[model samples]
Target: MNLETFLLKDKIQEIENGFKIKNGWLLICESTYDEIESKGIYCALIKNKYLEKYSSSHSWPINYGYEGKSNVYGDNSYQTYDNEEVEPFLFRKSFNIKDGIKKYIDVGEEFILFYRLFEEVADKQNRVYYFVNDYGELDEVIVVEPNKVKIKLKYLKEYITMRDMHFFISFEYMILRKTIDKDWNLEFIDKDFSNENYFYNHLIRNDMGTYQSWILGNYFIKPNVSKRSYLDFDNFHCEEFIIGIDENGEIILKNPKYESKGNFTFTYFKKEVLNKYYNNPIEYEIDSFSVSNKYFRLKIDNNLENIIPVLLTDLLILPENEQLHWKQYNIPITEDLKLSSTYYKTMILGNWYESPESIDLYFKHLYNDFNKKWYQKFGWNLYKPLAKEDEFNFKALHLITENNIKSFCEQTLTIVKLTIDRINEKEIVKGIELEPNTKGISKFQKFLESKNMDIPDLFEFLRHLQSLRSGLIAHTFSNSNKECKKALEYFNFNERNLIDIQKEIFKKSIRTFSTLETHLL
Candidate 1:
């Protein structure tokens, strides 16, 4: 039989039996150019009728001549077809129809059948075509072909699923495969499927509820398709059914999430997709980065040296309020020394002028005061001394006497003086040497000359005050009434004033040091 005869008979029989084809039907047959050409002729037969109906409904003049006299028609008769030609309706040229069939045939026989069924309903009331496989379930609707079939099928599937129906259908146009299965469903997979493992392991596995929560609350996916997934999860449903398995033993679905294992993890900083991306410890660049919380706990592998700098950089960027919580206690001061030695070394470097006994006393006072006043305020313990009581033996104290404090203070002061002279060359007031005329005295005299202020005499007086205080602290060994009163009086009378003056001096010193460091760098 001819193609037309076959289609007409089949459709006639279906309509006669009180069975109208639904909008979604699959045609699962191999077709050839000859078959498509035969179907094209059949498609043409009724194309004109749809065109006529469309034009008439839209009040467009028919392309063909009208029959009967003009006076026989009323004034409204021409108006009835006024806009028919302007309406957007399907109009296939003979060549385009032929070409479309040929293209369908190139996709192989099954696609040709789909094309044929698609054209048959192109102008018909019914928009569905069904393909039945005897080996599969009966009443099975394989694929639905329409211009908007994808969206339509999605809505249909959702409506059906909501009604608790077991069967659902989907179409694969690229491969021209039609599937009807009880278990098959739709799901959104990450675009970079290759690195899906990383996302799944790090993000999804820990909290599938997060995905559910996000979808339910935001009605959208987090790290949207345009960003991480590349697949829109909005209005997309997860298929509970596992269609089949691939050679690698992975489940494949009829409408599976299209993901490339290589494109799973997305790195914002790197601006690249990672296939085998992992959350393992690796160097990463961070700009203006900081954690919201105060205390940050880090887990490091056996090797820690490489990660410490990165961690420190992150801590430095934290706000002052936030930074106060980072208590750097129990940190190893040196790799090669005993803890006691490390503690003693830190104490000497941090507060050099204080004797070991004085260091212990100051730390105790500071710690108690901090715990009482600032611990809650700052959320950090700043007065953490390195040495424990057990490490502070009588022998250790004897070994580190007042001489150590005095020597360290003198050496540090000398270095500070040299640094000041080196930086303040332009500020020298010219030629005012002390009586000694030694290198140290000359340098001191030159420093006083450099400053364009009467503050030199004040500085000289403050130096004397510092020298006397140092003498009392070094020689007395005890904060006796005499030494204490002298020390207190000097600090109260001169030390406070000197400290205020030193603020501007320190500012200049810092600027000079920074400039020097920049040049060195």
Candidate 2:
């Protein structure tokens, strides 16, 4: 039996058997083309879509305005964006479907298009076909049929079958008003489906009680990452579903909020269908996020690196729930570092600036969203405890050893160096020469002294941190050395408090951000 009859019989049995027949439309997903033709159609559309975009790297020879005998001509002097000329008819003429398929001829001109799926991979599937187009240039047009389809329907099972078939062939889906003819055929009620609430209601199964919650609490959070970032949502469900035709001449729903991974006919609606479609968008909270993998860490923001190369170590965090599955070079899988609770604690209550306006002042003209990553990173990484392996082995791996501490110090000192460089570049402080053949802090201090400016206490704290690092870990010394005792006394830290000392340094580091941000500008 046809899909229409199969669905109609079930509906009739329900109504006749003393069941309440609800007034609703059955939106079915149906493919217009068979599998054999679909591959060709998909290829043609893909090629037409990206031909000019990849014109430079293509091996096709330039045959600009080449007229080889009859009907074989190329585009004259057409230069691509890369300034490379592309010849028309890169694809051979035998691939044209106009002669083989009659329906393709009805649509204006035939354009040969092809795309290699997974071209970079060893096993690539090539799809190519004649794309029908009346318009000179193809935009997102794939299928060459009536895309705005309106069907009369009122059955559930047929819809499920067609929906599953969408994995093999693309099709558009829409439910019109409940209408049927005398011969058990669904009748067309309207030209297009416009009831957004109705469509969302059925898909989301937002029954009478929870329907209002779905409508009122529907909000989308777009992350401040690149378009390719997984955290970035392409068609956040709040937006209307973008309907477009696939390579098959059928309507394919582009971006549905929910999808079925296994493309099979669902046996039960209430149990199978409802569970697959049900999702409470309101429960998606962005405020707090749990790491999706074993561990998560921060990376230095590369925002101003190309221009100034500032060493802002605590300036970016991995996206919430972003998984870090790969093992570090030396760290074994069994002893992988756990994300410290201190990371979360400081991130929640980080005091980076006196006010939000201070942030705006420093990050002026920078992307507004760029600061969000920095805010998360600075808060998380600031209070991270740094120590020798014997003292504290895991949490602060980047700053654990004497050499690593020296490297961290050097990296951290870039903030001061960056500030001075910016100051010199903008002529904020004129005629200042840092002390030669000295440590970074001494050089910075001499530069400040030459400018007749009192050194900030933040620098003094950094100097003490350096002293502690150099004395206890960086320099080779006997356990009872007098210099180690002197360094510990000067920094006001002893062997007992070595592990926790980083917390104080981090607090001091955060206090200086506003000052560095001011001078860097």
Candidate 3:
């Protein structure tokens, strides 16, 4: 919502003279005041009845203007204020009594007018302009073309004060800084406001500022139009909000909004997807055993359902339920997000990759496959491999350490081998020891070497890694074999070698897998 202000040619001239204004609130219209005076139309204006320091006053001593729709006659001036400034004329000329008059005085161009003290003034037709309104107290607007609504500064100032915010800005690479003086005056420390690079270099480069975090969620977001034009975050020469903190002390991220044709960066779904899609599922499970909890856990508090309203408010979006904070509709926080980055990625991107425009099927398919397999086969066993089974059921339980490692080992190794096999499909080798002629490197390693990739130990490592299953068998046998004594005497058996081999194999498998994934997978 914007405040309204009144103005006329005579009033503007008076303000331009020695008369002062408060908070610099006044509109300057292109049309002559005489035309409006003839109309006897009405309008309101904000005046500089009292010009106090830092209040930014403007004088509007209009001989003819409207305080309302009705006309007023005077050699005297009038004043008023509105966020939408600039427009002209007096009583009869102020506005039309009928629809015709309305069409005549269509405010063609207006400016939230202001003037600099002690500056030279040119003739009216060719005079320079500076938006000296309440919003631009610190700015020196040398050329405020009709195209720009400079009053936005007032709205911005209001926002800052009302919200009690802290900020840094760099609009489209233009350095813009705002600071408060000891007298509570908001001013700029612009070393050279004329030079864009000076601000960029000083604030962005030297001052360590960034706009990557700016997004729609943090601000009083609205459709980019009129008063909302400031929402066009990516508009060139536009101010970029580098950082901000809300009333709740949450970190406000900067997300520069770029222009798009008939589309928006953020979208809302009418309902949650209670129905799961079966076409290509993203199978993701929480990695409770993960070394880094951040990768798996949701950073938000566990009271997710309860906090959605707060999030929506912070995001400046309409909340689903304002009274949700009160105990009315009970929505449980069912799934704990402390599992993996998979959920966040998929959930965030799902909207963009949805139907209608199909550009990234290949990548999307891979993503779905990875997540599906992760949830379906990997994360289930991550924290408690073998389903909490003790050293008893070797045949049934997954006797491995981590959930995904075993499958990862198998999958990565297969990819590595398949890649190598693709390059050497027709070759046959006769070997007695792992390699026919080389130093214990397998065909896979040789293939990578030929391709000028780093060689990895494959056969040798797999030879040891393959012992895990056997080690499990031995452990089972050693634990409860009915003929253990007889079997030991006959085979001269000791489970130590198999046990040792299994441990080495596990280590080697991890190392080999990493190398293969790096070189080939």
- TM-score of predicted model 2? 0.22
| Residue-by-residue lDDT tens digits, candidate 2, 1-521 | 34343233343232222122122221111123332111110111112223333322212122212312133227554433222222222222223365662211111122211211111112112221221223221122212222111111111112213222110111212222222334644332222211211111112122343211111000011111222221112323221122322222222222222433332111100111111111211222110111112333322111211110101121113332221111000011111122223322333345232211112112321222333343454332211222343221111111112223453444333332222222222122235554446555655565556646564786666665555555655556466766556656665654434323433444454555555444432
Among these predictions, the greatest TM-score belongs to 2
| Model 1's TM-score against the true structure | 0.17
The models' CA-based lDDT, in order, is 0.26, 0.27, 0.26
Error of 2 at 277 (Å): 35
**What TM-score does structure 3 among the candidates reach?**
0.18
Q: Looking at candidate 2, what is the lDDT of residue 383?
A: 19
Residue 254 displacement in candidate 1 (angstroms): 40
The TM-scores of all predictions, comma-separated, are 0.17, 0.22, 0.18
Count: clashes, candidate 2:
6
lDDT at 84, model 1: 31
Clashes of each: 31, 6, 62
